[model samples]
Target: MTSPRRWTLRTENTGYTVRLSPDGPWAELDAWGPLGVEDGPSALDWSRRTHFITPADAAPAEYLPYGLRPFAGADLVASRPGEERGVWWDFEAVEEAAGSLRLAFADDVIGLRAVLCYSTVPGTDVILRWTELTCTGDRELRLERIDSAGVTVPVSGPARLTYLTGQWSQEFQHTQLDLPRGTFTMGSQQAVPGHAYAPWLAVQDGASEAAYGVALEWSGNWHMTAEAEPGGAVRVRAGRVPHEGAVFLAPGETLTTPRLACAFSPDGLDGLSRVWHRYERHLAGERLRRPRKVLYNSWEATGFDVDAAGQLELAKVAADIGAELFVVDDGWFPGRADDTGGLGDWYPDPAAFPQGFGRFVEEVRALGLDFGLWVEPEAVSPNSRLYAEHPEWVYRIDGRPARLVRNQLLLDLGRTDVQDFVIATLDRLLTEHAVSYLKWDMNRPPTERGRPGADHADHLDLDAQHVAGYLRVLDHLRAAHPHVTVEGCAGGGGRIEHATLARTDVVWPSDNTAPLDRLSIQYGFLHAHAPHVMSSWVTDAPGVFDPRPRSLAFRFVNAMCGVLGIGADLRAWTGEQRAEAARWIARYKDVRDVVHHADVRLLGTPADPTFGVQYDDPAAGRTVVAALSTGRLDGAPLVPGRPERLRLRGLDPRARYHDAESGSTYSGAHLLHYGLPFAWSADHDADLVVLTRQ
Candidate 1:
């Protein structure tokens, strides 16, 4: 007889509304779409439906606990020592503060409280949701699983899910499937967010262009499970610090789950990408103002033979070719002729660098290029003195042989002593040298993740503690040495997420830098992350994933799409090739601002005969399109046809544009309708075309 109580949340362009069901205090999503859609009846209200599951289970509640979410999986699972694994919670209070909304529920009998939190990511069509569980009872409770938030998409018919999946060097391969029924699950348990799958998902209503996206903001083990309900609603639940068993929660202590960002886009997956990009840029804030530098890393050139004379030689050529930063990769530490040793030895190898590390850095600075170094701080090799002295620091299960991944053992970062040691190591290096950049890489996930203590198996929240330690070190770097740029890498693209992105300047996309393979990797990466944070390298490796021998220009254009880096051995390149790289670097500096800050649009995928990334900067009256021909072509004609053109979007039709290369002019209307013509052929496989509004 009485109308249900309701609450509506809105971002710049979208809206989300939830209401209390008439039969119970539990909430259900009423409306979630464009602005001004909050006044209608909620499609997920259980009061309007008939039969099936419990009231809380049937209703599309925002967040529910164990006993309440009976038949279905609960967002929060908890239990006391000898009690049943469930809770009968009732709505207690709702609070709104500082643009954030919170709803609290309490189970008086169990002495537990759950708070669902929501806040809009300012200036964007995205809202972040998370949960906090507090132990209110006198006895401690165990939390087996606590998800950030449960999102219910108001969909009819089936839901199409889009996600990224792959391994190690071949990460971020976009994959999609239609789910007419049942549930789909994806996650990582390898301590760090593993390479098998990323913690992100996008759901579309059948074939509609409108879509909803969810991304978990966590660097540790996480999970995302999406289910297509029988009644046509799609529900997604995600969280972090996923453990095999319950983690103890003491009285008066509160555990907060990772934030799950929910976004809405009306223009399709491409448009949804812009929403995510804008949010990431917002997260960067003042850091976004800093330019993405063109760097030259000396990893592929001289692996373990990192001597001062050889490094200085490479630095001279790097400076000549317009590299702003010069990084000396691994194998620069003592006892480190190969990957088998010298991991924990942080000091520069005296034998390899007879001219002192500081002097080597000064020599690089004299060449007009900033100095950088690579360090893997969380791993220890048995051959190193640090590990030999403190072998207990490495993670190991008692009575079990230690597992070695990449010939190194993972440091138990959960220990405060280990965290302090890592901080001291990086701090001393940056303070002693004039290092402008630091490439922090993690080569492998923790294999035997265990603490040496007896109580750790059930009492210690190892994953959560390790993540906190990692973030603390990165935060220390950002605050203590603001001048240093930090590049985050975990065997390439393994540890990328919002929490890591907040503290680091850039992330290595993958170890597979082959032209076509990298293009595919970057294509999927840009959809979820901003380009400024994607560190792309032009390497001469003989194809780790793709074997196609693409031209130098093709490699340059592909790497230019993100923060450009050169890892090829410069001395091995021909004079003409060196000259060509210099030209491309010069050209890149001209359009780097637009490329980094502009709204990026992925024209087509690498699978297409002709695909490109279009950077549209309307405010600056400029657009840079790095078009590439991936498929086979002939001089007589482009693979598909000379008539094939890339129709541009998000431009004013009345404006006229001038092409920098051809010196030709065209109306914005013409470019939007017809598009930029690509003269693709055997000789010209790729072109970085810049256009200025006239």
Candidate 2:
């Protein structure tokens, strides 16, 4: 027998090896880590203690069904009408490429074939994995659980897990915990990926800096569970459209699971973030390097009192403040006097734009700025004309009452008819106004989530359908309206994933823009995602979430860390504040390229009194740093004996550096060793320092 074959998949710096023995019915992950790991004895080659349970149950099974691995949790679960739930599949065939692999397993009796798919992203340390299930028999099969991939991490004892979790106003809070035993799981039951938790997980040995990360690309209901088996092996399983009963698989019909992207980093979670960012940029393609304009949004300024004159006034101030794109946020549509109405309506309110919507958009553009608009396409208020005309378009059970959150019902995006209407609505708006930027928002999740007329309501898999239809519409936007830039938001950071990042130019992190609160939120966000896709805004100071007094300079530095946007009502700003905003905006544009496309390192977390981010680009000959004092400082900004300092990273020790703002020069060795000194006063707590290497 040909030794069941073994394949090693290589990314830029890591290697993952899987083995299938001719004697066993299942495959196992032999090794995973640095490139040369497979050249030596696999760490998994150990003595087996499989006395009571089968080898498939004791081994690190890649992906298995119930019967063969009856003890452990299974990856695939299926059943025939009058048959058992177990699927005893046998390894059948495999297809391998330079950086890709596909393993097939078939259960002849059940007439089902499952294929595990794997491929490496070209330029990054990321491997995308998914699954394909084909029903080969005449009778339809019910698929209860079909996961994308099963990841096995070999460990001696406990493993550490890191994930992002938070709620509506406070999203993307970095969380970490120990997985010493049992199973830890996180997921979203809402039709959309809710604000509860992001579909991402990272596992590392105890305190080791080396980390392995897995993120689901599906923006629908999903689950990621990490199980630390009794034998000291940690296994993670992830999938989308989950916990919703089952789906019917007819003969010859195949269902492809969503891709689960896997990444590795030797330098820790911070390093792992760059891996994710690189892959996101790879996913973005041409949109990656595109200039992210300095934007000004008119939501907090005008609110529902939007009108032709008020917006133009704001536009003049925005253009004067160096805003490249001007966005008219919510309350622009008819019937939208408040959040309780005018959600589904696509056209602009004639009363607000009596001069005509087309002319208003052109007028905003006339101020040397690109015009933008915000729309929540997947929601409908009871008072909306679209909802009144097509009440059946929303998700609802036949005779059940619909629950309304935020006075709106989520549209059934799964339906092709609904997708068509959404596409048509957005296309018309973009075409009529010649809009250059679009902010697509979804305010609520599905409550009923039912298709009234479906034959097998239990097997509908509404989440999958909705997600597919949503991606379809996004694809149409990319193809048909390629000239328009898109920003994705689900209330705020609720629906962020690779799929959304691939399609949209940026995403809103949170609704709370108070400096200190937003600083922590952006800190957690940059740990898991890249800066290019992060849309940070500077709103009014000392408002709402955090009432702590913060300088406008602090607010600008906080927002400038990402794609800078001024959400504050500039018309209300004093002349000094407006001038300061213009200066900061100009400075951001000067170093925006390095900030967006350079090596980023976060120094001292929010826990430290002075924490900030460093962006370094040797090719650009620029190194920018934004340091903010989050806690109380001692007497004197520049203490005689102990000056507040921040040690820089990724700098040559022997090189000389010049400070653009202060005309100060120092050795890179001294800057990196003793650190750069900050003379921050009580009112001046933050600074954006630019350094040029000489």
Q: How many clashes in each candidate? A: 0, 0
Cα RMSD, each candidate: 2.0, 1.9
Q: How do the residues 292-330 of candidate 1 rate in per-residue lDDT, one tens digit apiece?
A: 889999999999889999999999999999999999999
Instruction: Let me know the TM-score candidate 1 reaches against the reference structure.
Output: 0.97
The lDDT per prediction is: 0.87, 0.86
Q: In candidate 1, residue 464 scores what lDDT?
A: 90
lDDT of 1: 0.87
TM-score for each candidate, following the candidate numbering: 0.97, 0.97
Task: Count clashing residue pairs in model 2.
Answer: 0
lDDT at 678 for candidate 2?
82
